[model samples]
Target: MNKQKIAVLGPGSWGTALSQVLNDNGHEVRIWGNVPEQIDEINQFHTNKRYFKDIVLDPAIKAYKELSEALDGVDAVLLVVPTKVMRLVAKQVAETLDHKVVVMHASKGLEPESHKRLSTVLEEEIPAALRSEVVVVSGPSHAEETIIRDLTLISAASKDMETAQYVQTLFSNHYFRLYTNNDVIGVETAGALKNIIAVGAGALHGLGYGDNAKAAIIARGLTEITRLGVEMGANPLTYSGLSGVGDLIVTGTSVHSRNWRAGDQLGRGEKLEDIERNMGMVIEGISTTKVAYELAQELGVYMPITQAIYSVIYQGASIEEAIKHIMSSEFRQENEWS
Candidate 1:
């Protein structure tokens, strides 16, 4: 195992929160943010005012405006930027990165138009010649809860076990737990598709659907995610773990969730463009649902919940119509796929 200097590459809620955890763990940390004012606040006040105001940042943490400075001499890096900018940001880090330091990411969701999982994009974007050190940290981690030092658990996955363990230590705190897994594909795939389900579940909640429907959505949503993930060569059990089921439960129902907020608007008959533009946060569910809908088509999988979400958002299907469609569908034994 290597003692590594880590850089968290984004300064959004997730990025800032990850940096705070690492700083608390006594690792030398630096971060690069595109926003000049955000960087200034982090440096001078030792706090992230944009997303996390209640938690005080450790004074020892550092910030760099330049990509070179952020990636310089770091043994590992966490790519915490949005899914859309992942490739562009990864390329910048790959150019200056030292081979000894591994790369870990905390971002989730696939590129909708490209239909690529985040890890696939990372593999393609990062300089292939830099050597294999890519891993992902995901699960039921929310930036708001993490900033308050809540007990959060995440699954760290890699093709390499040592790298995964290294990541486990980088962000793990007394209040935060990290678990290791070698199923990188499983972890990333589940992480992406599960967001789509969360959005659907949120839509159900917003429509005043009862707990019966919520529980059904949660279970059936896992089934859809698992089916797709398994088709992509992921472990079936990964969906049952924290990064899969745990994430779905949190992002599905939490008021702090941007994805759920978007889903609620859709349930309330708000336009997708308006919801997206007005929310201002990265409502990953919007993008993830579209990608998952296409993926289900490509894979010939029956993902009814995902399809219903796609219908409501893109096909101009009404909330009541989607609900009726789901309820009116054909019936089957519960253990058919189990």
Candidate 2:
């Protein structure tokens, strides 16, 4: 593979982890962040102490405070920012972009109010003239393990096969692997919706529920996710892939997941505002829950798991009450694909 200069926007854990991967692949990585202290730390100490305390980053992974300077002469742009700021950052990238580049986003969430996927948001902000197909790189990978060079595999999904294959080649290494898929809609939907189930799983754990409850959440949550995904014209088989069931299992079961952590706090009777304040990172699942709830209602899709989590998060309903409601509801045959 030819060495390329790539710009990575957002210096958060995921962004920093991916930058390390690109650097490992012998590519010139320019990481852009808004925080001056983070930029200085990456430059001076070769570490992002805020996110990864002990791991040292490569010296070749240069950090930049200026957006334009980072985007300068880059071959591809990997967006790892929060879903809330995706539009703003993509717009800024569009305005600063002087040439076309392969644009990919690792964000997982639907746009609030618009109810559009992150790729749709990216497409709206970044013009077709300024970029290639909007690729969504998502799956069960977590940044904490990824930074330590643990084995991780994820999907590189796009409508364009060449672009997806290019991204797969760009990020693949001994420790990290990428599988290319053409189901952009399924990948994005599964990636985003799984977070909500993860929140529910974490909440169940916090409530002292055992493995049985959590397992039920995972299985039923996938059903709800696939239901909505299919309603939105996604391939049903995609739900069984890395970005769907794989992501659901990892995020819902692991303590490393931000959405799960937030849900755990919620289960312990903590306020959403307090949890957000303490986490100091964007919990994409919180907003994703709202969007999924609204979208399910709009589409007339039956999403009991999403609805239960939504009630707890939005309606201020008690977690126990929500679970009770779910358990006591009318019995139905399993494996109903509707």
Candidate 3:
């Protein structure tokens, strides 16, 4: 692959890890973040101590405080910002961009107000002439593991196969492998909705539920996620693929998952505000629960797990009571397609 210059917006853990991947692939990577101190740390000591504690970044990976400087002469931009701020950042990138570039986002979550996917938000914020077909890169990989050069498999999805294949080639290597998929709707929906289940998994673990309960939550969680995804026009089969069950398994079970960790804290009787402040990272599930719950109601989809989580998080229902509510709901066949 020919060497290319790429701008990675959002210098959070995932963005920084992806920058390392691009650097490892022999590409010139410039990372942009809002925090000046973090950018300074990346440029001076070649480390982002807050996110990747002792992991020294490649010296070749440049950090920029200015958005325009980061976009300068870059062939593509990898956006990894929080979903809440995605639109604002995309607008900034649109203003700074002078030419058309491939814009891909690795962030997962729905827009709270519009209930749109991140790609749709980008397409709305960015001018059509200055951006290529927006691609979504998502799967089971975690930033903490991926930064250590661990073998990670993820999917690069787009409605346009050419754009998806381009991203696949750009990011693929020995440690980081990419699969191209055309099911952007399923990929993005699965990626966003799984976090809601992960929060429930963490809550169950905190409530002293064992592996059996966790397994039940994961299975039933996938059902609700698939139900909602299909209602939103996603292929039902995509729910079984990497971005679906693959992401759900990892995010719901791993210690590195912010959503799961937050849920655990909630289950342990911590306030939502306190958990958010302590985690110092965006717990996508918290906000996603709100969106998913509202979306399910609007679409007339029954997502009992999502509804239970939404009550616990948003309505201040006790975790124990929420679990009871889920258990006491009307029983249905395990594989009921209706």
Candidate 4:
């Protein structure tokens, strides 16, 4: 593989892990973050203690406080920030771009206000002249596991196959493998919607429900995700691929999942504000649950799992009551269309 210079915008755990991957691939990586102290720690000590704890980052990975410096002359950019601030960061990157660069984002979650996918937000913020087709890199991988160089498989998707392939080539390595897909809508939708289900699964675990209950959540939650994704113009088959079922399985079952952790806290009777404060990082599913609930209603999609999670988070519904309602709801054929 030809060596490339890549700018990683966001020095969070995901961003740091991806930067290490790129560095290991013999690429030059520059990471940018808003926090000066984090940047300093990364540059001086090769560690981002706030995110990765005691893990040491590759010394070759550079951290930048200035967005322009990070973007200068880079071949591509990877966005790993929270979905909530994607637009703001994209606009900043757009202003500093001097040439067209392949732009890929690994953030998962829809814009709550506009219900827009992260790629759409990037397209609106970054002019087409300065950026290639937006690619979404998503799947079952978590930063904690990825940083440890654990085996991980993910997908890089775009409407343009060549764009996806380019990203696939850029990030793939012995430990980190990537597949290319042209289903941008499906990939983005699956990546965003799975977090909602993960929250439900975590809630199930917190409620002292056994593996059987968690399994049920995963199955029903996937149905709800597929219904909404299909309504949003995503290919139905995409939900079965790495971005869909694969992602849902990992996020729902792993303690590494921030959404699942938040949900678990909620199940234990913690308030949303307290959860967020303790998380220190963004709990994307909380906002995503609200968005998915609203979208399901607007699109006339039936999503009981999503609704239950939303009620728990927003309507102050008791966890036991929500699960009871789901269990008592009328049953339909397993393959019944929503």
Estimate TM-scores for all models. Answer: 0.95, 0.99, 0.99, 0.98
How much does candidate 4 score in TM-score?
0.98
Residue 19 Cα positional deviation in candidate 2, in Å, after optimal superposition: 0.4
lDDT of 3 by residue, 1-338 (tens): 89998999999999999999999999999999999999999999999988888799889999999999999988999999999999999999999999999999999999988999999999999998998999999999999999999999999999999999999999999999999998888999999999999999999998888999999999999999999999999999999988999999999998999999998888788898999999988999989999999999999998999999888887878999988988888888988864
Q: Report lDDT (Cα) of residue 14, candidate 1.
A: 87
Model 1, 5: alpha-carbon shift in Å?
A: 1.6
Off by over 4 Å in 3: none
The residue-by-residue lDDT of candidate 4 on 1-338, one tens digit each, is 69999999988888889999999999999999999998999999999888888799788999998888999899999999998999999999888899999999999999978999999999999999998999999998899999999999999999888888988998898999999988889999999999999999988888788999988999888998999999999999989999999999999999999989988888888888998999999888889999999999999999999999888888988999998998899978889878
Go through the candidates in order and give each one's C-alpha lDDT: 0.83, 0.94, 0.93, 0.92
Q: Evaluate model 1: give its lDDT.
A: 0.83
Give the CA lDDT, 0 to 100, for residue 120 in model 1: 81
Candidate 3 lands at a TM-score of 0.99
For each predicted model, how many residue pairs clash, with residues at least 3 apart or on different chains? 1, 0, 0, 0
